[model samples]
Target: MSDPAPDGLMPFQAMEILKRAKAMEATGRTVCHLELGEPGSPPAPKVIEAVTKALPQAQGYTNAKGLAELREGLSAYYSAQHGVSVDPDLILASMGSSAGFILAFHAAFRPGARIAITRPGYPAYVNTLLGLGFGVAEIPLTAANGWRLTGAEIAATHAASPFEGLLFASPANPTGATVDREGLRDIVDTCARLGVRLISDEIYHGLDYRGPSVSALELTRDAVVINSFSKYYCMTGWRIGWMVMPEDLIRRTEILQQNLFISAPTLSQIAATVALGERDYSEEQKAGYAANRGLLHDGLSTLGFALGEPSDGAFYAYAGIAKFSNDSLEFCERMLEEAGVAITPGIDFDRVGGQGYVRLSYAGKRESIELALERMAKALR
Candidate 1:
């Protein structure tokens, strides 16, 4: 056997597709990239200026929690943007939401504790929890219900097996389905009643095309909230994010951060502090994403792809491929090799129900979306 694939670890198929697409580009082929969810735009000019200014100073580590100035700014961000008052001390800077997930998983859950996540959810949530030795309970969602996670699902899942935590994302990846405020409140109330710790992944907060995203912090301080500058702020390479820790988990997460990370990158912390003030620039970027979304939606539908609900937020279009092929992976491979287009197989997000689906990211330029759709039409249509 070929090294008996690591137990409980599944490949992130999107990144795997990205790697292959890059190798093809190395051969001087011009591939239209829609596989990864990275912003086509660069960081705001003001953010760059701040980082350049900070570069001359010694970029040493901040304390485990991160720079006080940045945390204070994040506090103000919640107040002004979300209408919530979060204490600066409870906010811990992390190395992207990836690290924030790791920290939150470790600090919040006991060893071998079972955590519930939605099927058709972010792959990392399931993989990370499994890699860390936690039992994963995937609650299945469907297009019939608009791909929503609900209080009934949580309560029913908990009643059957009794998980210790529930981790979910509104404006979720692959689908870009957002839970509205009323729906969110019900889920929050259910989790509280069922004694399940909630972890909210709000990385796509500012990219909501429907309306503003509802922060879990607005409903409960007990939930562990995680966010990053990667998506809406277009700062992926910076590898910086933040977590609002539950009061009980603060000291543990801080101690874990001290040993696990020491601190987030000094330069990124400085950049993020300035990024919070660049909402106008972020909004302009969001408008571009909206146009790209419309382009992708209309193009894919014309090609007979059934996207359940139009993405309300985030920059992804999760489309059903039943009209094209039964195997999403094979379909994606053929698309890449023959059509010179790159997108992710839906099996990366939902192992069971995703074989007939694929996710195309609209986080790239309008030209890329147009090109990919054109190439796909010529090849498939």
Candidate 2:
């Protein structure tokens, strides 16, 4: 048998921190969770009601691409949210963005293809590429530049050696910095010029605290756009995500999804269709995230943690912890053990410049944020 795929994948540090925090809780310690990026709010009431109503219908497998209604709903959503028209036929739903990424990699790239990904990015991007026997060109980002990845950076990296694909995220994970229309157009143009396939991760689009998040779909029809109900919709456990692929790639992705996923959770697809129509529910959740973001920003700054840029969207504050410790892993471990506050080490996102950084997720309740801050202040002092 093949040796278990190369063991180069790093585990998500936030989940590991959660496990440790749970163990502490088991021992009667109260822990404030600031590690994972899950929303504190529950799924929309309409979503739950829809799921409950559909449960007795013996919901079965949907088309590999997704239910017609959900796909249409997603198309309508994009049209309303970004003012971009999308064809329902181009949408394919998978278990989550994770599975969508896998299907996309298989459909768009061949084994051994070199892909460009930004460091200080979601770890799963690199891990998944390596697992599929692909070469990765990691472009490093810095706090000085607000951690933005530009077309110039991509061009410089490609000049060093050719790469076939590029993966990018907006309102990015960990840092939460978002690019504007002009910047996005530059990257899209560069990718087209270089003949590189682009995969845009827009999972956190609706969770923006600053302004609207731009979708790659607005600028190019040549890219694969992946999104999920897991973040802004507060449905992480539902395991539903969708991808909008170029017209030519639709059939290929559908075949891959047919074999790999068969369908996204049927119940989730049904409920998500309803969830999309409940705009007020989603807006309320976004408001909570905005409040939590402010609390984390002021609280962390007061604790001397340096933030790179104002997190334009998403519910995280990736702060510099150099003033406390250069070893972020050790620092976080100590925080969990002594401060009763759990956070993720930056190494999981940025292997090179991460040792002095930490990612604090502010998706928890206001009381929890206040408590964590108080405990962190006392422990660090």
Candidate 3:
């Protein structure tokens, strides 16, 4: 038999190409970066100012869960935004949503359990579950369905042998696809019947162009909601994210957080609390991203790209380029060397259809995105 897949499958694909491109650029080559979904805009000035002013007092940790003030602020935000009352006792701060993944996986899934996740989904979901020895139940989504997993699809795949939980992202990464009201409702209903937990990643919730994204907490009280200030608020490097677990999990998670992360950085928590009060700044950034989203969509179509689905939210467009290359990694390497553009290969997201597709990040400024689009247009032609 062939060699088994390795356990520690680090995110080395993009990094490998990046290092190669860096070496080339040092020799006087120009490179356009479209590989990473990093916001070109900096955090709102109000948020930055808050962080600056609070740095002095935020030095010491108050509690492993989070500062009482910060947690209260987050609880109020949930009530205001979702109209769903969240008690301060229910929230826990963490290093990032990525940290939430680790803690949630370990505490909830139990060892060797299975997790239901969509194919061509965030690759980390698969790797993280696998690293924990949890088998993955892939729910392959199609473009016709907006690349979203449905209740019927789940029943088809695992109604008999259901997983312990279901993990999904709204305005999903890489594809930028959003689930409709019906799809979300159906899946939630099915999971209830099968006793599968639901973990919803709402990192891109407020970054949508079509409208504000949906939250899982609205559908069920038992779901785990993960969110961050990195996207809509332009606070990537801050590394602050929150988790809203069921009341029972909250207690377990609080003790878990104490031993695991101690607490999210005290300074970041202070700044995040302040940022929630600065909605004016965040809304301004959202408008800019909305414009960039439209511009990139039109530009990609003009460049002859077949978008997988309408990007209802987030800043990526997963497109097929079968006419160009069957091996996306090779295509990406060639583009980096010839066009001097840094784009992530879809193989990082999907092992099946990935070879015929690639993901483009439009999180940069208008000017840079225009230039990259022009280069892709020329290179693909």
Candidate 4:
């Protein structure tokens, strides 16, 4: 039999490793989980309260496009927060950004067409592209650029091997790196010239520390904007999210969304609509992430783990683990086994340069994060 994902990734592979760790925990080993991007905050108080009132009315599925009320809330939220206007008619709801990603990937590009994404980015991006039978094109972004994507890089990159679309995530996974407004505009303009479909994974929107979040809608109208209640709203398990597409792509995306997910859950949509109204709570969570990022920033530097970039957003610090472990996979397993710290090996991210890195997440409670830093300090030493 052939081996699956010669790349060492797969939702199942992640599960297999986590499963063993989970099974081991049955015997009661301490596990400090820093491996996943799963948010750690409680759902907003108002959202939960809405759910309490929605149970009897939300037992059945709603329209395949999701509750119009929820879609309208998303539209208004984007316009008010981002200085951009999106049509509720253009919104297609799905079961979290995972479903949105698949639908967009399928609708935007055909199988065997190439797609470009940054190295050491979200592992799921590469996995999703390949699973759709597409070619993986690499754009090696370095720490020098704030891990930012430049127009020149995209234009020069495609000269060697081009792609049909580009996927980007500011305040990105693992590294927590982001781009400024000018940088984002450069990337979008270049893609427009290259005839590349741009899919901006704005799942981590509103989680930045330094400045405002930049949206693709601000730069170009011809991109797929995928977002979720999963991140900013702290509704990870509810499986609800949405997409913003160009006017022309709306019907096509709706067709795919219909077959792929009969409809978004009725209760979750009701709850998420209320979430859009709770800006104060979302900002509070963003502030907490900023504080955790600072604690981790000072602590990790003290522990001697060389950081990849000056992380300004998201909840992770991707570091160069070269001094301690030549192999990130072996290192992650050892961190779990010896230090009781669970972290993700970098190989799951950038296949080429990932051997020397591991990611640490600060998404846990304050005390748990401190405990992890204490243990990792010793492990690194």
The lDDT leader among the candidates is: 1
What is the Cα-based TM-score of model 3? 0.94
Residue runs of model 1 more than 4 Å from their true location after superposition: 1-6
Which tens-of-lDDT digit does each residue in 1-381 have in candidate 3? Answer: 012267645564656667777888799877887877778888767777887887777678658777788889988887888778888888888887888887777767678989988887887888788877888888888877778778888887786676888888988988888876677888889888878888988888877777666788778888888888887777788898888888868887888888888889888887788788888877877677778778887887777667744588888888887678888888888888777888878887887778877887877777877888778778877
By TM-score, rank the candidates, best first.
Answer: 1, 2, 4, 3
Candidate ranking under lDDT, highest first, comes to 1, 2, 4, 3
Worst 10 residues of 2 by lDDT: 1-10
Overall lDDT per candidate, in order of appearance: 0.92, 0.89, 0.80, 0.83
138-225: candidate 4 lDDT, tens digit per residue: 8998866667778999998899998899998998986888888998898899999999999999998888878989898988889999
Query: Number of clashing pairs, model 2?
Result: 0
Candidate 3: stretches off by over 4 Å: 1-5, 8-12, 19-28
lDDT of 2 by residue, 228-254 (tens): 999988889999999999998999999
Candidate number achieving the greatest TM-score relative to the actual structure? 1
Error of 2 at 282 (Å): 1.2
Candidate 2 structure, TM-score to reference: 0.97
Compare candidates 1 and 2 on TM-score and give the better one. Answer: 1
RMSD of each: 1.5, 2.4, 2.4, 2.0
Candidate with the larger lDDT of 1 and 4? 1
Question: Candidate 2 at 42: error in angstroms?
Answer: 0.7
* Model 2 score (lDDT): 0.89
For model 4, what is the error of residue 16's alpha carbon versus the real structure, in angstroms, after optimal superposition? 4.8
Residue pairs clashing in model 4 are none
